[model samples]
Target chain A: MRAIFPAYLLALIIALAPTSVLATDDVEGAYRLGGGYALGDTGLRLGGYASTEIDVPRTAPWHFSLSDLSLFLTWDNGSRLHFFSELEAGDLLSAGEDESLGVQNVHFEFERCYLDTLVNNNLTVRVGKFLSPIGQWNIIHAAPLVWTTSRPVATENLFSTHATGLMLHGSVNVAQHLLEYSVYGDASETFEAHRSNNPFENAFGAHVRYYLTDSLQLGATYANFVLNDLQPIRYNLAGLDLAWSYQRYELSSEIVYRTTHHTTVENTWQGFIQGVAPISQQWFVIGRYEYFGQTQADAGQIGLLGLAYRPLPPVILKLEYRLGEHNEVLAPDGLSASFAILF
Target chain B: MRLRLVYPMLLILCLAGFPAWAAEPLAVVTAPDYPLSSLSLDDLKLIYLRKSQMDAEGKRWIPLNLPATDPLRRDFSRALFSLLPEEQEEYWNIQYFNGISPPKVMASEEAILRFVASTNGAIGYVRKQKVDPRVKVLLLITPFPPN
Candidate 1:
């Protein structure tokens, strides 16, 4: 714990040293600084501007509090390396499930750490832990960076926010169209479970993306991941996504159909349509509608609405509300507000 | 008819003298066979921008630009990218910062000629008279006559 402070500070200095003095500083001028804060952790749950539950009616408790601080540094070339590590100090004093999730564990994890290098010319290779480049949206997964607080159910079914491994990503120009492609080989030591935010055993996946246009993208991914020593379920995900972004307004949708080797389990599918419209240059309104069918026994739909304020190019502050429903134990519905920063 | 012969002959002689007054414009050098066929303005934009690679016949089109400061480079950008000199700088700067390197640029017209002559799909432009058996011209960039 003591080591992290000095190391982080040193990194900050090294990264911030004005490179303009150097002649090759074409990329030295582009760097961003950002972080987030929340006020409550009790029933007043909110992450950033995650969602508004009342408008849509979700019965679950909101997860909000003072948590998740980050700093992002980028460069002039689209190639970027972002180190997003969150320190949840709120739970430090909390005991456990008994007192409150204690911060004593001081759980430290890297949201992203990668070096994006464009090889020779066209090919780009990303090494280290980074967002899985499975789809257009997953690569830029951040609460503050996004218009909506809650991502669609499709994202949940398709891939995770971060993946650790080497990603080969680049674009090729065909006859008249541009074909953007990415092939990733992930080798993360551990994986997070989907439900309950539980820690699962080690997991890994292979992902790919093909862009039909500047805005529209088609993707397919496969994960031969294991969970809790259960027979490794061969998870297969095929998805179609259409996204268009302009200066002020943007819309993106992802529809994924998931199938596994287990025949007893029902094939599942989910989708989401997310839209953001700028009210002004600095402020915007965002909304997302998500639906998923877990199995014959359970399925639900969710809606999210939020407002975002960007004071600068790379810094974003958002306030959001989300409403979603499920079939059983935890409650028929849930909502959460979250604040996330992107580098 | 007999009386008008002298006036008609003088008019013909006057018309014949005009060619001496206006020198013929410099001709462009391009590939003779393929002739850069089927590429629209947008297609050319895509090719030059490195979004499109293969030429119409599937030969990897090595679209070469002159070095940044070269006159030929400016001429190509002005004609194709449709950008003024300042705009071209900004346009390439954004792309450069976006992690995209510009197309390969040769040092001089002779360097382009040598390289294009050696490589099968290589492409470059030069004066019409500079053309020879060593290379093939694919297209032309004629200058607009001054008003």
Candidate 2:
């Protein structure tokens, strides 16, 4: 199954290529810069993004790699039903600083596949696999949309990044303010598990976000899950996050803590605060600080400063330097650069 | 002498108001039979931003947009969101990644009028003077004063 997935994806892309070309002639002005190509009047659209990164570590071998190549398909019935899916192939090729280059064994996985049914103006029911709505970063983590090349540790480690099952999500307006909520659960294993993923067996969680003002939002999340580890430990997790923007400057932060029911020594927690300030219309300066700790491992802290340039909305170039103490594998101390484009 | 002075003053006043009079007012239009007769400014904002998909009646609202470079589009965006279409690029980028696309873009106001008139639940904006009986006008927007 794992080996055939890529072949299937290749065939799908090949089949869609001619349709996309025909769509350009059938639909007037069907293509936009970042937006996908509409498949005639059928309501289906095809789009994707790609990114490459150069990693230079202080004590490790430097390398350059094709980090992510992702494709997505979306269909809207123009009424009550909508469908979306994303397939990603990561680390397709790599070259070491020692003048060696080769095609790396790639990991192909379905990042998101779901159907959304509109129940009303204030509610939507979604079934299948979707990004866990725990915080803002996880859902919009695409390379072209984010400010930095590296993700915060807390956002990736504290909970299941993807949930396979069902979710009920909605938003309502109250006195000119917006309130959004989601409740989701997954009882079975992931549909197509990737070796790098930390899949979970059973989990349920809820998230709520309130827009205090047009530029400020606060969110809270809670979840309980059994990690698919060798011993299958059960854990409870909680988190809080904030996002605020004034003009072109922005600030965001999230903190997550997890506790195991079987052992006190295995509890873990992490937090981070990131800020982006616009230097000009297309240039930005970013700074972030993070701290991660586990009961059984050395606690670590890291700080990063980066600059990003967006020549266009869907194209970005980033360079950053990282410094840290008691660093873990995820938070390496180094300099990294990346270029990404969404089409 | 008094008559001459009054004539000059009147001429200056007319000249000062010429731009405002020549500026075309925009109208939010939809199918003649679209359920709602009017939409609040807040609702319009939400709909265009893709924050609100369905209306109070549980029917979807398909919003249409003019090309970003169109003068009418610039005026409409400024009047509706207080931002130019170019300024909202970042917002649209994030929305695109989340599988929520911005309103479909039409080539011209004529295309918008034709689409909105024939399609149910369709909504678009066009010049008030160009509005015909084929579409129903929901809201009228006057261009903001230039800075």
Candidate 3:
């Protein structure tokens, strides 16, 4: 019942879109079907993105699914105040032949809803739920924008992907290099339903980024969180990320470590290095290797090879093959393909 | 015989047109009211790419662009971003997801200059020959990237 509200809101907005569709004449630029329309002279804009995936594994049954359908609404009250909201329905449809027959895996929920205000030129304050600015992937994980059909297991499982509450962020220039930082805290369990994806109850985190050059960036993040369950377990995490690009060649990597104390202390780490190159105007080749380890379980590594073609910037066609050692049952070696579009 | 004749003809045409093509220069322009009269190439890149928002005075700086199909616009994008069209598109896709849009686009160089001249924070670029006294020249370079 909690999910019904977002579904209705999405339907209502989409239904009301056509009336202002004709008034969006002056917003002349590339027209993408998935791109939202500017609502006349108002500051409101609406857009959405969706993706479908097909996975074929060696031992398990092939799965075909509509993975994600999400809509975003942003309202800017001039330069001072901004509002952003996202509603997502994941695993909306799945082939019911075998594995998915009795799986109740569908979810409709609010992903992000935040209000941001510029306190000054160098500082901004945000209130509400948002993607944790821990690393690059967590913020920009939309399928159409990401290169691979599947996400790195390390990235998905290492940290809390979203948080609810207050965040303060700013950037300053120091010695010709831009330094950016964000500190956030989720003190109260106010929006429990909206923040179900957040694994922690009380959390505080900070991230800092350094832009050494136009082509190079380095960042570090730290967070302390408490599990919301009966016996609130305490945990501490640290992460480092790097991005570098030169012309058509690009490289990015991220590594994160976590430690938790309940009865005793345990430490775990995960990381991945990804490289991408454009072979032609429309084609890009990508490769990535990832490692995941824990004190209790055996360490594992996975490698992926993929290629993507973009007929248009808003549309992407991706195919990848995965090979792994250590956890084949959880993340099987398989061929995955997906077509995604952002409008 | 046909091949030999076409080769020399092509070479002659290339030799004759090279100097004329290379002579055109690009002029980066901002409003006269803007404090700084000149900018480094890196500064220009930051403004055009929407990575930087304010001028030295703390007032907002608005970047203007020409229509994508215009040759002058193509030249500016290729030279400044150092990216192919597809790569540029990919870059903008990411930007859009992050809630930023491309710079405002004008219809012609005259419109660009007129806008820049009237708007205090406006910035745009065009062929050097088309520049007028209305707008201040921030930077100038050959239309083609330096080889």
Candidate 4:
């Protein structure tokens, strides 16, 4: 049943394409690179992105896998109401020298499914499951959108990535600057839990971002949640992030601290700063450093250097190497490469 | 000797003014009944970037664009955002992942004018000469001096 969900979605989207095209008087050009196909004047759109990765670690067998295949649908009523949903199929296939080439256990999950009603210019009410607006990276973490193939621990480990409930979000212009904010809460279990991710039973969070300049912005986040465990531990978290870009060079950083009420080791914290510089029109040099301190584990520090090339706007190729003092599973020392596309 | 000096000065003036003369003027246009008469450069930038969706009156805006390769689009982007369409790819990618698309693109300036004139809240850019009475010119943009 899980494996067939993606197929069913794809079929549905394809089936509607011709009908939508025929209904509209004017149809935009066939297919755009990153821009999805507009399902005519119906206010519906169909699109998705996929990524493949190869990993070579010193302590483990080298492997190649289809990391992500995601399909998203969006509907806008040409007014205040909007709907969006994304379904992802992960780890679809794998191959290695020691392991035979074959289909692997695929994980299917709904990344986001939400309805947004624009109450006014200053506020929007969103209901359903949506990405937790904890930091810049997590909200735009699609494979083709981010600079790095591997995510920083701080972005994922300290908090739940998705929340199921309600969110109020909007942007306002204060003076000459732009201030954007989101306040969300989840009082129920996650809609469809992915095995790899930690979901909260009850959680609430707020994120605020202020644009200091066109190229730079600062962000703050706070959240409190209860873990879905037998013991039901309660945790509180706070995070800060910064992003700045000028011409072809960019710099971004994020830091998060989490505290639990029930544990003797009360706190865990992590952070990373990343920079990207253009080497050529289609190539970029990327570098990053990360630090993580877990409650009952040795502190870990990692440094990474990478290169990315984009032959086209919607496609990217990346290669990177990671080295760290604590070469554990969370921060393994290895070389990795990926090819990703947004269509 | 005087003629030579005059010739050089005239040449310099023409060279300095070449960009404004060579580039076509653009009209930021919308339906004739659109609530606002004009838009600030900041608001225009936000609309094109998909950051600002509603106007001061709380009406949703339907921002439109030209094809990526169109010279008019290149000029519009350069004049408004100081960035080329290619340079905006990364930004659009992030928006796409978040389910916010870039503005819908029309095939030609004529189509843009027609759409903007007929549809409520629709706004687009076109050659100044191409705008007709049916549409309202919200703002007039002069081409930037070439780098």
- On DockQ, the candidate that comes out on top is 4
Q: What would the TM-scores of all predictions be?
A: 0.53, 0.89, 0.83, 0.90
lDDT for A241 in candidate 3 is 92
Task: Write down the lDDT of every candidate, Cα atoms only.
Answer: 0.50, 0.82, 0.76, 0.83
List the candidate 1 regions with Cα displacement exceeding 4 Å: A1-21, A24-62, A71-106, A115-118, A157-160, A189-231, A295-297, A327-343, B1-147
lDDT of 2 by residue, B39-146 (tens): 888888888988889887777887898888888989889888788898898899888887888887887888888888877777899999899999999888887865
Docking class of 2: acceptable
What is the per-residue lDDT of model 1 for residues A146-173, given as tens digits with 9 covering 90 to 100? 5555456567553455565667766665
Among all windows of 10 consecutive residues in model 1 chain A, the one with the lowest summed lDDT is A38-47
Per-prediction backbone clash count: 25, 0, 2, 0
Regions more than 4 Å wrong, model 3: A1-30, A33-35, A99-104, A191-193, B1-17, B20-25, B34-38, B56-58, B118-120
- What does candidate 1's lDDT look like per residue over B1-147, in tens digits? 776998999889998875443322222233445445334556556667755544545445555666656655566666665553444442343332222334546666666666665654556666667778776644555543222
TM-score ranking from best candidate downward? 4, 2, 3, 1
Q: Arrange candidates, best DockQ first.
A: 4, 2, 3, 1
Worst 10 residues of 3 chain A by lDDT: A18-27
CAPRI verdict (incorrect, acceptable, medium, high) for model 1: incorrect
Best by lDDT: 4
Please rank every candidate by lDDT, starting with the best. Answer: 4, 2, 3, 1
Task: Evaluate model 4 with DockQ and give the value.
Answer: 0.53
TM-score between model 3 and native: 0.83
